[model samples]
Target: MKKPELLVTPKSVEHIEDLISSGADAFIIGEQQFGLRLAGEFSLKQVNEATKVIHAANKKVYVAVNALFHNDRLEALDEYLMELQRIGVDSIVFGDPAVLMAVRELNITIPLHWNPETTATNWFQANYWAERGAKRAVLARELSLDEIIEIKENSQPEIEVQIHGMTCMFQSKRKLLGNYFLFRKEAMEIENRKENKNMFLHDKERKNKYPIYEDLNGTHIFSPNDMCLIDELTELFEAGIDSLKFDGILQSDDYITTVTNLYRQAIDAYFDQGEEAYEALKDDLLEKIEVIQPPLRPLDTGFIFKETVY
Candidate 1:
């Protein structure tokens, strides 16, 4: 099996060098106004600078324009895409079919990485995207290992999976956070009360809570625990995944460095010495991840083992 490319989300230009040094083979840089992570968005100038940095290390950079676009934004989107193509961006990751069509219509030739943001659960979906000019498909986080293996076996496009990071459980375009605060303004002393900076939601029925955040795309409710697949590198490699992605846009630089290094070590160990070495390093890697991850954030295997309920 070919060794999977190690992809990482670098929130800023400052993180690019460290990410490259940490063994990242490629990066997914968020667009300033059109990416999922508003907090991690980069200006066009920053994107240009970041691309230079990533290319200097001989690694690739994929710009994230994965937000669903509206009719009003089509002109701007076309212009932005042309600008990206001019700057030699390696690829554009997008979720909207209209945007993909726009890219094609504009004759923008940078490869597309289709991230439908939901429901890329099978090989047929991957093949569908491949037939439509997508070079890669970021698989949905809801699939199990066996399902992923099946998709890899049947798909035509290169497969990418989020091996470590937050799993978004819910996403909506409405400004829920703003509306909530507005509605509650009269219920309490609005002006004097501090906004709940550390925002989260507790599910009474599920007896769990998840991190919540709002941005240009809307409100996102993430899974209760961050996904940690440090122990499953061998499975992913054997399954023929083309890339393993680390999502750290919302995490600290130290956290990104530690997790990236852990995965890097695990991937290198597996490819060089085989499964036994990979297994032997699991505990040590997990310990390090725990140490570096935010104290309050929990880690779990995510939906890799069990199917997510509909």
Candidate 2:
């Protein structure tokens, strides 16, 4: 059984040490101007400091340069990527070609992780980016378990998957929440929208309230059920994924620590004792996860088990 690297997005530079201790093998953190919907943003100086800390622990740190860039943002990008390279970031997660161009221009040696999200569903797309210098591909969350395994088997780039946490369903580059408040003639600060988790969108027919919020990039909505795959770790390990990401977005530090530890244990158990022992522990793991996760956000395997998602 291959042991995959366990990745998580830390809430802050301060949380890096704790997450490292809790068994995260790599971290994804970035600034809001360059990254979209990140769990936490760090100043360039803070990112330098973070890289040092992660290196000291013999773990990896990846900066998210994954935003859909505009013209203004591109001007500072080359400098940002250069600084990240100088500070020794393990790799960068990016969705834009501008970042690739900037990396080429600066001659930065940092590996690129292509994460175009929904478009990263097939082995061909992963290989296309691999040929262009991307070292890894963060597979789209919409992929089924079998789809993911097939990609890993066929793709040239190392495969990464989001196996846990809140999965975003929609993102728009507009202040949808703020515009709604304005339409109703209510007052609310546009910048404070991300903090307002109490706000949600109810599907008229389905009656499911999907969590919604806004930040620097735009307004975003998440799946009603959070993704949980503790029970499926054995299959993913068998598939030989390069990394497993546990998104810490919209989650507390305690929750992050608890869940990371659980997954870490599950990963070790599966490799150390094999599938039967891992299966025996799955029930206890889910029981613990349910206690920490928000009561309203039920846990499901997301699109992993679904036959058809469209």
Candidate 3:
């Protein structure tokens, strides 16, 4: 079986060198002004410098411009994209059709990676983007391994899947966190300062608590548990996944290094030895991952084995 490339999200410029050294095949960098990852944003100069560092190491960098665009941001968007192409970015990851349209209209030659949030759940949607000029499609987190296999067998574009890290359960353009707190203060007639704070939502029946935060893009509710598919590396590779993405844009450097290294080791083991030897390394991998991940933060295989109901 062919070994899949490991794609990682760097928390900052300081974290770039370690990630590259940890056997990451590519790095996904984003800026706060235009990308979805507000916390892990890098300045343009920083990104340009980082691109040089990554290129020197013979790796690739994909800039995340995966934000929904409004009419006002078009001119700036066009200019920024030109700057990215000039910097020699490998491709741009996008979720908005308008942004895709803008790229075509401006005649930007950089390859586009389509990630239409949760819409890429089947082969038809994957092929639709492929036909429209997307070089790759990041499959939805909601897909099962069986579904992904079918899509890969049928789709034309390269396939990318989130093999590990935090899975977002809800995303909204509205400032739900800020508005909720404001309404509470008003209804109770209390004076309070507007501050951005991390909040949690509790589920009595399931006894689960999920993290909620707001940033430039909007409010986001993430799954209580981070996704971990270390044990499934062999299966994913066999399924023809072109790339495996590790989502840790908001996590610590240790988290990024440990996860990337673990996946790197796992992938190497699979290709070097085979399935049985790879299975033997799972316990060690999980233990190392547990040490670096946040205390009490749960981990699971996400929806890879089970189906999700609408």
Candidate 4:
């Protein structure tokens, strides 16, 4: 619909390099998890390792530093952020406002893409980040189609959407069952009760015994959803969005291929024939894509224009 562009956002540079070798136009490299070091490029000797390889293949790279980090980690982040800037990382995607401001303070900068986990849903929110110096903002996974269009129309920065992969239930960085699993199991004697709620179990059977995470207001829920946007590619492009992204760090190559093919075919078909062309190929498209894990709730269109879910 709009100019066809593909952004390969790998969990790290290894997968990104692999995707580049395969056929990705751009990359988003995040090193925070590994302590803020570029994966492939080791030292000054490997100066060109990241930039040269990707540039040689005619690809772009966006270094994601940290969506969430403490004030203490700022000095540690400087060197990594500086390296990305010096190497001219195409853009930077971050969730923390402090990180955003710190990058600007670096004096050497490029496009700053807001991480979706930060939740810029409405255009006013999107544009707020734009004015604060973000180049592109990944629309929140919860936004509806209409909301996406509205964001595109109003936000000054370029917009990108995650068209495929696991949709996270909590902020990318948050306390989780990781602690609940660790502490609750060991210290709580109730977990060892002869007849119990079975809270130790990972999966549920009966609704009454269901393991629901309770928040102050209610229960906080998280489920995996396969994002297959092939059916709506045309409308999105026509809406003036800039990029389509895929989420597949946990998927196999075949899964990635299937996701890629459907979107690619949908885009190609729209220009070649009409909207009907993609519809004609819809069955095969749907067939190629299968959900490894469906949301416990059900398949949702996602928040392109409305609230995440009722």
Model 3 score (lDDT)? 0.83
How accurate locally, in lDDT, is each candidate?
Answer: 0.83, 0.88, 0.83, 0.59
Return the clash pairs for model 4, or none.
Answer: 142-303, 143-303, 143-304, 144-303, 144-304, 144-305, 145-304, 145-305, 146-305, 147-305
Candidate achieving the largest TM-score: 2
TM-scores, each model vs. reference: 0.93, 0.96, 0.93, 0.74
> What would the per-residue lDDT of candidate 2 be over residues 242-270, giving only the tens digit for each residue?
99999978888888988998998888888
Order the numbered candidates by TM-score, best leading: 2, 1, 3, 4
Candidate 2 has an lDDT of 0.88
Query: What would the per-residue lDDT of candidate 4 be over residues 1-310, giving only the tens digit for each residue?
Result: 4565676554333444566654566765554331221222233223336667777778786766534566667786666677777777677777777777677688756777887453666788778888888888788777778878888888888888877664555432332434454566643542343232123224544431122232211222343345567666767868878878875543455555455556666666776677788778866666556453322323334554345444
Higher-TM-score candidate of 1 and 2: 2
Clashing pairs in 2: none
Which of 1 and 4 is the better model by TM-score? 1
Q: Residue 206 in model 3: shift from native, Å?
A: 2.0
